[model samples]
Target chain A: MKIVLCVKQVPDTSDIKWTENNTIQREGLESIINPYDVYAFESALRLKNKYKNVNISALTMGPKQAEGMLRKLIAIGVDDAVLLSDKKFAGADTFATAKTIAAAIKSKLSDFDLIVCGQFAIDGDTAQTGPSIANFLDIPQVTYVKEVVGYEDGYLTVIRELDSGFEKVRVKLPALICVLQGEFEPVRARINGIIHSQQVEIPVYGIDDIGLSVEDAGLKGSPTYVNKAYRAPQKETECVFVESCEELAECIKKCGGICE
Target chain B: MSKGILVYSEITSDDYLHTVVFELANKAVELSKKMEDAPVMALVLTKPDLINEYKEAFQKSGFDKVFYVVDERFGTYRTDLFAKAAVQAVKQIDPEIMLVGATCQGRDLAPRISTALGTGLTADCTGLDILENGKFAATRPTFGGQLMATILCKKYPQMASVRPKVFKPSEVDVTRDTVFIKMSVDLDDYVPQIEVLEFTKKLVCDLNDLDSAKIIVAGGKGMKNAEGFALLKKLADKLGGCVGASRVAVEMGLAPQAVQIGQTGKTVSPKLYIACGISGALQHTIGMNSAEKIIAINTDKNAPIFDICDYGIVGDAFEIIPKLLEL
Candidate 1:
């Protein structure tokens, strides 16, 4: 079985600071693997353990520096790593990003049996990249997948968490699944694994290497454009500060009035 | 010319029209009015008889036309089939803007349709509007909800998905002479890729269902223990609402994951959200900010929750929540 797990490096948004221009201060920002992707990697490792001849590759699209993140994936037990990076890929919306990734998968990891992606990325939070990539690859996709239950007879059984409940589904091979964060501690990379990762070469694919035109790989390829970014308007209620619980009750009665 | 704003109507697992349909319909009416009162429309794909069950809702929600494709395959939502039908519907209607409620199904289905149509889709938008030049504008939180960006789609039939509760439905219905158009879809060579084994409803549905709750009383790290959450539950019960918890509170075992609200948790925009003992991290605030009214009670006046809340009370939840219950 061959699996390609898509991963992303996201800044720790909790520790993020904003620039005066309302953009994120990316310099000196601490970046880590997307939490959900960590779960996806864990899922792949579990499958590797369950079945013989199971190979896993970690794929990501970002800046060239993301190779460092890819090496970390290799260190954490991914048999191979692929980085799709280029300045031409900057400011790409979900469409363009998925386009780049689907192209990379076709050119680099052709005949892959499965694609796994984190349900959402912290920076973008779009949750569209995985499904769009599936569409670009012309494969079926299942989103909000909680975990892979097992594999049998070329079909993979998985659980999908919906708003109201959970659905257990069995998808055929060559499908994509977007994984949700699960309750498991991620495995740490051992010393020998880290050393081997440093010694191995990880190929980086730019837009040209992937046979994509410059105009069709990034912002130019994206149909959506950010018109403006600003702080969400703060609610201006004058925040009548009440000192005691009794005063709070009185305030709600007068204004909040919804309380009986 | 692309002349209408189309919204998707979903029949939920509970076998009823998801309330978010009406919410999006009302918002579409507002956006359409700004676009020279362009027609507001909807698309529903459900079991054959389900369209009749939802006709009154479409009529009362101010839709000028409701295009529906009834098929047995729609009994269970398979992305390929739904997207195929939706793509065909959009190609025929040629609406200028397409809006879908950012529910679990909508989030999963909208992007597929957009990708198939080769158009831009802004996901989980908190704001939607029309620019002066008649382009669709969508605003959503990016970077873990730390910043907000308003976007525009250059392609035709611009698309976006807004979460439930972000917009309130109009109190008064604008009943329209709705045209129910029964459309047909060609599903040739489209096969189901996944087989359904079972669907198990989580027994804790009531607590997790914050989507339709009109009011929510939430606690945070300041709500020290289960006892603190018990008080919140009492207040929630008194107010005829549900109880919610911040991530820290959930981690502390003060509440279950089912009731957690934050960037990672469910996005809730109830009529009234009473945040008790929450310090208002950007993560927690982003989920609840859409509430029509917010009242924050915390010991520290400097807690950021007070900044975005409609009212601030510098008191302990242990003391204040009980008083609110007394009222």
Candidate 2:
């Protein structure tokens, strides 16, 4: 079984700072593989360990800097890595992003039996890219997947987390599954694995490599755009302190106006 | 000329609309009033029989028109099926704005629908308003709740998903009336390739339902370790309240994610919110800020939690919690 995992490099939200103009300041802040995508990579490695013929590949789309994220994936135990990087791909929304990924997948259609992704990228939190790519590819896609059951010849069974409960879903092979964060423990990076990853060369594909035109893969393809962003004015409220339990009780009673 | 607002009515298994749906309906009514009798549209995607169960409720909740998409395949919540039906409905109605509850289903469905319709979506919004030109202005916390950003959608029918309990539901008027419109959708048109075999509800601790609890005891990073949360649990039991944690607590593996109350966590509104050793980051305050009264018990008097707290005590929660429990 061959599996392809899509990973994204997002600014480490922990160290994120804002510009005076309200735009995210990514300069100097480190970027890491999206925390959720780590779960996807781990899940793929787990499957590889379970099946002898299993092969895993990591796929990502962003600037050339994103290739570094793929190296981390290979170090954790992926067979290969592919980066679809192009300057024209900048400012692509979830739709265009999914289209670009779909194009890459189509370019390598015969190499994989399944595609996996993090449930959502923390930066965007849209959670739409995976399903949109699935829609674009016209394949079955499941989001918020927490557990994966055994796979049959042509079908895969998995459990999805819902608002109220969990649902068991079965989809045919060559489908997409987006794993949620903390769904599985991530694999530890081994020194030998890191050494091997340093030797593994990542294949970078551009718009032409994926057989997609610039008009169809980047900002031009994105329909949504941010018009303006401004800081919201804070609402004013008065705070009262109570030093003792009796004072607290009295304050509560006064606030309620003694119940008429 | 008036505008129409579409609300994706989130439904529970017990057949009642979720709290957030009603809140959005109430907000829609407020927005509609401002827009000169703009119709508040309720979009219900459910089984045909389930439509009747919600008709009166929608009417009372101030929906001017209820669009019901009755299909057997939509009996369950599937992202693709629901989003496709909703996008089609929006296209047919051409509402000026759409609102959905920021629950798991709404978070999943709204983004997809926005993508399908090629529109912008603001998620996890805390507030909504209409601009002079009738554009939807959605406000949500950004920069991890350090700042709030109000976004405007240049596209028509601006979409937003408001957090649950962010807006209060209005009093239901049983005598209120509405126009019902039925939409026919072909289930086979967009078949869900994935089949749901069964649903298993995780047994989350019932003691963590902080929103409805009269009293809530919450801990933060200052709680030290997992054992600190155990102490919070004991205090919660004594107070007959539920236990909640900040995002830090959940990230530290001190508590389950469900019980976490913060910007990225559950938004809880309780009568009394007791902060134990909580420094009160902005992200944490967004969840419990709506509480009727807040009491902060932290050793650091400079903790941001003290700024918004109704009562602040400059003492150790570990030492004070035990004394309070004995009292």
Best by DockQ: 1
- Index of the highest-TM-score prediction: 1
Q: List the residue pairs that clash in candidate 2.
A: none
Best by lDDT: 1
The list of candidate 2 runs beyond 4 A from truth reads A18-25, A109-111, A183-186, A213-218, A231-260, B1-3, B34-36, B154-156, B172-176, B189-192, B202-207
Cα lDDT tens digits, model 2, B126-165, are 8788778766788777655655667776566788888787
DockQ of each candidate relative to the true complex = 0.61, 0.35
Worst 10 residues of 2 chain B by lDDT: B202-211
What's the true lDDT of residue B318 in model 1? 90
Steric overlap count per candidate: 0, 0
Residue B24 of model 1: what lDDT? 97
Tens digits of per-residue lDDT for model 1, A54-127 = 98998998888888988888887888888888999999999999999999999999889989998888778888
